[model samples]
Target chain A: MASTIRVRATSNGDITEVQALIQHPMDSGFVKDSKGELIPAHFIQELKFEYNGKDVFVADWGPAVSKDPYVKFSFKGAKKGDDLKISWVDNKGASDTTTAKIS
Target chain B: MTTITGPLATRRLILQGAASVALIGLGNLPFAAQPARAAANDKYPEEAFKQKSEADAIKALYGKTAEPSDKVKLDAPEIAENGGVVPIAVTTTLDKVTSISFFVAENPNALAASYKIPDGTVPSVSNRLKMAKTTNVVAIVEADGKLYSATKEVKVTVGGCGG
Candidate 1:
């Protein structure tokens, strides 16, 4: 499966807000394919974000979630051009990470 | 601005897309990209809730043998320019509604969203939903072991990105 994840960080010399959008089918693995065959279940099991060695957000999701997951969250005490790291792992053991600088 | 053309553009989309899927961090098994099914006593337990028609959507949320009642109210815009984020509200005049759910019949997955209504929180909720096209929005309320419903149609002029 292919998707896209975009992360944008904005800082005003005091607060840093981050927004992320991930494209995914979020299939719960309970449906049948075109031939009416049962498709295997799969979904994101966990997600975590860290900034400057501090935990920002952690989420445990199941199949009930939606497709192209989108998240918006903010934190205080950061400046423009700072690095923010985000990562996610699905039930299938797949993982990826990306970084963005506050602008 | 940079221009990406022909096969390379398609390749870029796929590669970028693959990176996103990897970020999702799915499980050990192969990634399955199908929608979740509905729960038992509902419809397709593993697939997203769907309805062939407006009536079917109502039945899935309420129950196959459930009957329609006026206690449930659906509030939607008379017209919307963008189907991506149309504001909708569901309120029930009934005494106690255990839960409330909204459904879009024409969407790839009929079950748009659902909410668990706790006691004394007021039997109403408001949120935005993406409509593939002009379609019926059905509100299903579970009250005192019974399911009641109401629906409203919003005219959408412009569909979301995918249409």
Candidate 2:
């Protein structure tokens, strides 16, 4: 599957900043389609960010979140050439994982 | 030309077999079980998500009241032409920040989004949100076991919910 995440990580002195955009529909189940039927809720329920095998950031989301979520965070203990991985699972049991290198 | 069982019995057996196969298929998918496992131990804040009033949603989520803080900065446009997607950004300089949650007082559901900030991570987040009508948007930050918040009113020229 194509990677659904686009990440940019850069280190400024000691703090390494990470910004990511995830592709998702985030259907809230409240919206109705053209047929006037409620769309079943489909959203990312959990998102985890790891830096060199250590958990750095985690998010628990609901259907209320908007489509194509954007997240930005920074942490210490990460240098250039370090590995940053992000994974997320949706309410429908679909998920995606991607890795990026800190610049 | 053999004796046949009842239709209901046969249907039940077929359903059971299908269910077992579906369960096994889900188990085989690596990511299928991930959310289920986390949800088993995590709280969903059902009441909070269902609330319509801001006060009630905050009460359901935090239980305690939140005090206004200047450290919390909620950035959004003073006037949003479109309510379908209003960009919001929150940043705080509070020590030991734990979580940041957003609430739209006028939406069908008050609690819009909630984010958990892990230790050592910067206490900032940005996302687009849907607004049902022109209303106040609140950002609450939890730090050192205390709740602090900031609020901003966004004027929507066009409603997002077909209004």
Candidate 3:
């Protein structure tokens, strides 16, 4: 599967800032189509960020969250060229993982 | 220039006294309790997320009430043109911020999302939220064993939650 996460990481002093944007519909199951039919809930339930294999940050999201979520956070002890990974699992049991390098 | 030293001096002293009281209150907090609580490996409150009411969701998530604070900043549009995608951001200057959570007061499930901020990370997060209707969107910050929050009413032109 193609990567669904786009990330940018940069180092300033000792703190490394990581920003990511995920592609997802994040349906809330409450909206109706033109046919007046309710849409089923489909949204990312869990999103995890890791640094060098260690969990750095995590988010638990529900259907109320907007589609294509964007997250940005910074952590200490990370340097340029380090590895950062983002992974997410949706309500439908689908999941994806993508890696980026700290610039 | 007219000098009003008498009244100004008294006001300054009063403000100083209030600032000290606030400082003392913070100093008396149980700072050690925060790390111990965060270390327990707290899991996501599934029941809270399942709640349809804001009060119940907050109760299940924090097990306590949150006080509104100016220190917590919730940045969102006053009117969301599209309910399907509303951008919301929260940032807090509070020390030792452990987590930040978002809630849509009028959604079918009020709790939208919760983020666990690790130590040494900036206490700021932004996400797109779906608004079922026009309602208050709240941002709660857990810092130093206390929960502080800020709220903003987002007006939605179109309902996002499926009818």
Candidate 4:
């Protein structure tokens, strides 16, 4: 299946700045559908970024986060061409994984 | 002009004393018991996120209240035209920052998002959040086992929570 995650990790020898954009409905459950029925909450609960088997950053998000969330963070100790792993799990247990090379 | 240094240093000391006194006036004692918590990195803070009140959410997440601090820099729009995607950012000069969290005062649930910053990660994060209406957006930084916060009011034109 196609990944719903797109990430860019750029390294400046000392720090690796990561920016990710994820596609999700992020339904807060309070919103009503076209039929006037409430849409159940189905937002990403946790998203993690790993580098060299270590967790660099982890985000625990609630439904208040906007749809198609975009987050930016930076970390040290990763060099160019290194693989950075990213993954997330939504409230409904749906998830996606993607890897990006630091450049 | 070099003789002005003597008086400047004395003035700085007086200002520092006044700042502490102001803190006391607000009923916050400096360096109170810090509720050190284990790193529940893999576990989602379900209870905290479900809290409707900001105080309850912070209590549920960190087991403590935060004191307002100038060191925690919160960058947010004064007026968010679209409450659905209000850009929020937080940065701190504090050392040993472990986590940072956002709270929307008027959202259905106050706790919006929390980010864990490992040792190598920078103590800064930027993300978009949903706001139900005009409200105060708070950014809390947990540094060196103590919690400090910064807040700003953001006017929302359109509510994000569906009616």
Candidate 5:
């Protein structure tokens, strides 16, 4: 599926940090049916973040995770205008990549 | 000797067998259809969570006199194209944030989600939420031995409940 990501940066001028948000269903198969059948859990197993070709963040996720997962974190040394790239892959083998620049 | 008896008994047996088959099939219909119904009924608890006003959800999660604070930063889209999954993130620069949570003001239940912040981990969390319609999304953060909050309006374009 096509994915979109947005990045926003708010700094105290001392620390020019950035926050990124991604959109995807991190479904975990634990949900059950009314007949008591299990909804197979599907979720994002891994995520990788890079800033100008340098690895910045990594996270491992599971079914307990909510759908359309969003991720946010801080990174130092970024200016008012820099590139932040993000990509994620789910257990279902679906993946998306996008980028945001500091503004 | 009398001719072979009429086929009345044989015909009766055949008819009885057919009737039994029909009855069995009818009896199993409900049973066969139950699993699907059960699955559909198995919506996330948040679906039943009553849609409350933003103020109400805050009170429910914190207490009668919950107050918003600056320590909590809640981020979400201004307009969500689909209500099925809306991305949400909660972060706090608070010195000691113990936990974070997401609550849907308009959902059937009050508390939509909760998270425990582990020691050594940053006081932040992100996840997708299932929204039934347009509603206010509230974020609660337990930090520095107190609770703080922030909120944003999320517009759901498509209903997530098979609507």
Candidate 6:
């Protein structure tokens, strides 16, 4: 299956900016299906970014996050051509990981 | 050495069964929560996220209250056409920032997200969140062990019932 996470990181001088979009239902359990059954809450609990063997950023998300979440942030010390690793784990213990190069 | 080993064996035997049971019973106690908090780098903050109000969520997450600060900048839309995906962003000038968090006052659960800002990372975050209705959105920045906050009111046209 294709990776659920898509990330783009770019370096400008001393900082690298990162933007990521992940595919997930992010069900908050408040909505009902067509059958009127409540959709169980399913959302990414955590997402992480690592660079140079160190954690650059970590996001802990709750059900209030929008479906198909999108996030943007930046960090220093990573240069162009460096690898920035991104990963996420959902409430059901499902996880995905991918790496992107800082362009 | 032999005398010490004798007492060591005696104590281990005395503690073996009792200790296991005691630890099991102490789940959710301070003793267990301490270690869980110590290892919170990977632990999902379950209690913090489950809080129903904004103040309760902040207290559960940080165990402290935040003061309004000029150093923190919270950006949110004046009117959200779709409550499911309201763009929110926060940036701080405070030094030694350890984390940032968002809370929606009227959401069923107040905490929307929390971000750990490791050293060398910029203290700015942009993300989308679901809002149940028009409410105050607060951004808290934890820096040097102190919490500072900024708030903005966002009007929502359509509630995020499932969004």
- Among the numbered candidates, top DockQ falls to 4
RMSD per candidate (Å) reads 17.3, 9.9, 17.7, 17.2, 12.9, 11.2
lDDT of 5 by residue, A1-103 (tens): 4555666765554454556566655443434668777667566655666766765555444343456566565555556667767776776788778877666
**How do the residues B25-141 of candidate 4 rate in per-residue lDDT, one tens digit apiece?**
667322222222323445788778877888878877898889999999999999999999999999999999999999999898999999999998999999999999999999999
lDDT of 5 at B34: 29
**lDDT, model 1:** 0.61
The sequence of per-residue lDDT tens digits that candidate 3 reaches over residues A18-70 is 88899998877877779988878889988999887777888989888877888
Global fold similarity of model 6 (TM-score):
0.85
TM-score of each: 0.46, 0.79, 0.81, 0.85, 0.45, 0.85
- How many pairs of residues in model 2 come into backbone collision? 0
Q: lDDT for model 6, on a 0 to 1 scale?
A: 0.90
**Would you list the C-alpha lDDT of every candidate in the order shown?**
0.61, 0.81, 0.84, 0.91, 0.60, 0.90
Q: List candidate 5 stretches off by more than 4 Å.
A: A1-103, B1-65
Residue B114 shift from truth in candidate 4, angstroms: 0.5
Better structure of 4 and 6 per DockQ: 4
- CA lDDT, candidate 3, residue B72: 100
Model 1 chain B, poorest ten-residue lDDT window? Answer: B37-46
Question: Which pairs of residues collide in candidate 4?
Answer: none
5 versus 6: better DockQ goes to: 6
Separate clash counts for every candidate: 23, 0, 7, 0, 23, 0
Please, what are the lDDT tens digits per residue for candidate 2 over residues B8-125?
7788899999999999988865432122212112455555676678877777677666999999999989998988778998999899987888998888778887777777788998
Q: Where does model 1 exceed 4 Å of error?
A: A1-103, B1-45, B48-62, B161-163
Ranking by DockQ: 4, 6, 3, 2, 5, 1
Locate the minimum summed-lDDT window of 10 residues in model 1 chain A: A57-66
A1-103: candidate 2 lDDT, tens digit per residue = 7899999999986999888899998877777888888878788877888987877877777666678888777888888998999999987889999999999
TM-score of chain A of each: 0.86, 0.96, 0.95, 0.98, 0.79, 0.98
For candidate 4, the clash count comes to 0
